[model samples]
Target: MGLRVQVDNLMEHHSQKSLFAVVLGEMQDGGLPHIGCRCPRCVSGRVGYAACLAIVDVRGAETAVYLLDATPDIKYQLNPLAEWLGPHPQRPNRFNPPTAVFLTHAHMGHIGGLPQLGPEAMAVDGLPVYASAELVALLQETRLWSPMVQGLALRLFSPNQPIPLAPDLTLTPIPVPHRDELGTGTFAFLINGPGKSLLYLPDIDSWQAWDAAHSVLQTVDVALVDGSFYSLAELNGRPPVAHPLISDTLAFFAGWPGELVFTHFNHTNPALEPNSGAVATIQQVGAKLAHPGMRFLLD
Candidate 1:
C-alpha cells in the first residue's frame, strides 16, 4: 500500500485555525480539487480559513484517504479524495476494506467534513467515522450536525482505543487536552501499518496536558505536533483565554524522544516564514514544519 499527504494552502489564523492545506492524493477525475484554489495568493481557488490534509494511495491504485483535519475547506478537501477513491457520486455504494475516516477533534476545521458522507457527495452508505464519544455526542446535541450524523450513519469510538482500519492497518485515538468548548473531546491519531507508524496531533492546548503521566510520546515513527502560535509573546491583541502557544510546544519537543514534525499553524506563528529567523529557531531544536506537498513514505 502507498501512503502520502499533500497540503492545499497555509491559512490565516486571527480568530480560528487559520492555517494551510496538505493533499494526500490527487483525484482520478480531472483537476477539480486544485490546491492553489482558495489560498490568499491564489485567485483560482476559494478563500479558506483551514488547510486540507489528505492521505492517499501511493501507487495511484485503490487506497484509503483520511482528511487529517476537516478544516473549513472540507468541500475542497473531500472533492479530491472522494473522486479519487471508489466512493465518488458516480460510483456504486460498495464498501471497501482498508478504508476509514478518522477525525482529530470537534473543532470546525476538524469535523466539518462529516457532511460529505451523504448522497450529495460520496454517497457513502454507512461510512464509519472514528471520533471520540463526546465528539459524537456533541454532534448529536447540536442542530445541523446532529441531523447530519443521524442521516449519514457516522460511528463514534472511544479515544485511545485501537481499531482495525484495514487488513494491515490499525488506528488508535490519543486524546489530547484542548479548549473543550464543543465538548467533542480533542485527540491526535496514531496510525499503524504493517511496519510503519505515524502520530497526528493538530490542536492541543499544551503537550503537558496530554497523557500527563503516560508514555504515549515515545512510540511513533512521525509525530506531528502543534504549531498554532509561535510564542506567548505572539498574543498581543487577544484578550485572555487559556492555551499554549507554539513557543510552549517547542519546549515539549526539546525533550521528546521520537521523530517529530509540527503543524496546524496560525498567522501569529513565526514559523510560517519558512526562511524567517524565528522559524530558524524552531529548526535548531530539531523539530520541523509541515508545509504543502511534503510526503513521508513509511518504511
Candidate 2:
C-alpha cells in the first residue's frame, strides 16, 4: 500500500496509538447536523464535531497532550484521550487538561470551547494558551471574557516565530489570509515533531490569497486543510465566503508531494455521507477526508 493508505490503516488501530497527531473533528464552525439545517447530510444523521486536532507526544516517559483548537464539542473531543491525560491529581472525576491550546483565529469554532476551561467546567488552572499577540490581548484585556481566562496562562506568539514545546518539537505560527473581523489576526500552525512536520490549517480564505502557500505546504509532511464547502451550491446562492472551496483546493495542490487531508466540512457537504462520490473524488485525487479518531504519526 501507499504511504497514505499506510497512515490510514495505522489510524484505525486505536489501542496502538503512539506519539502522533489525531484528527479530532472534521466539521466547520457550525459543525454537521448544523443548527437548524435539515440538509440531507444533516437529516441523514451523519455529523461531526468542529475542526480540531490533538497532538500526543509520548517521546519521553511522560505523555504530553496538546489541542490545536478548542471547539464547541470539546467535552467529547477530550474525553476519549482520558488515558493519555491521566486522572487529575486534585479532581476525583476529571482528567488532566491538555498541555496547551493553540488558536487559529478568533472564529467561534476556534475559541468557543475556552469557557469550558473556566470555573464551571474543567476548571483548568494555569493551562497555557498560545495565540497571536493581538489575540492574547483581546482574550486577556476583554472584560467580557475575563472570568473564563482567569485560570488560563495566556502566551503571545509572533507570526512566523517558532515556539518550542519539547526539545525537538516546535510550533511555528504562519499568518494566513482569512476574514479577520475582530482585528485579532489569523494563524495556521506548522507543528514540527522530532522526525516529521505537519500543517494543521483548518481555516484560510483562499490559497491564492497567500503567496507563501506553496512553499509552506511543500515543506510539511501532511496538511489537514480546510474543506468547509464542497462547491458553491452549498452556499445556497449567497455571496461567496472567504473560504477556499474543496474543489479549488484539490486542483491547486494536486501535485504537491505531501499527504493532503481534507477537513472542516460544512453540514451541507455531501462528502459527509458514506456513499457520496465526493469522498471517492477526493481519493481519486490522492487526498483523504479527515474523520474523528484518525491518527497520523508525526515521527
TM-score of each: 0.73, 0.93
Instruction: Report the lDDT tens digits of candidate 2 across residue range 1-299.
Output: 22234334544564353578887788999886799887677777665789999888866777788999899988878877777787999879879999999999999999999999999999989999998889988998889888788999998888899988888889899999999989998889999987789998998999999999988987899999999888898888999988998899998997798899989988887777667888889888899998877878776
lDDT computed for candidate 1: 0.56
User: What C-alpha lDDT values do all the predictions have?
Assistant: 0.56, 0.85
Worst 10 residues of 1 by lDDT: 10-19
Model 2 C-alpha RMSD to native:
3.8
Candidate 1 C-alpha lDDT tens digits along 233-292: 666776643455666766666676666776666544556655888788878888777654
**Which candidate tops lDDT?**
2
Superposed Cα deviation of residue 159, candidate 1 (Å): 2.3
Candidate 1 clash total? 22
The total number of steric clashes, by the backbone 3 Å criterion, in model 2 comes to 0
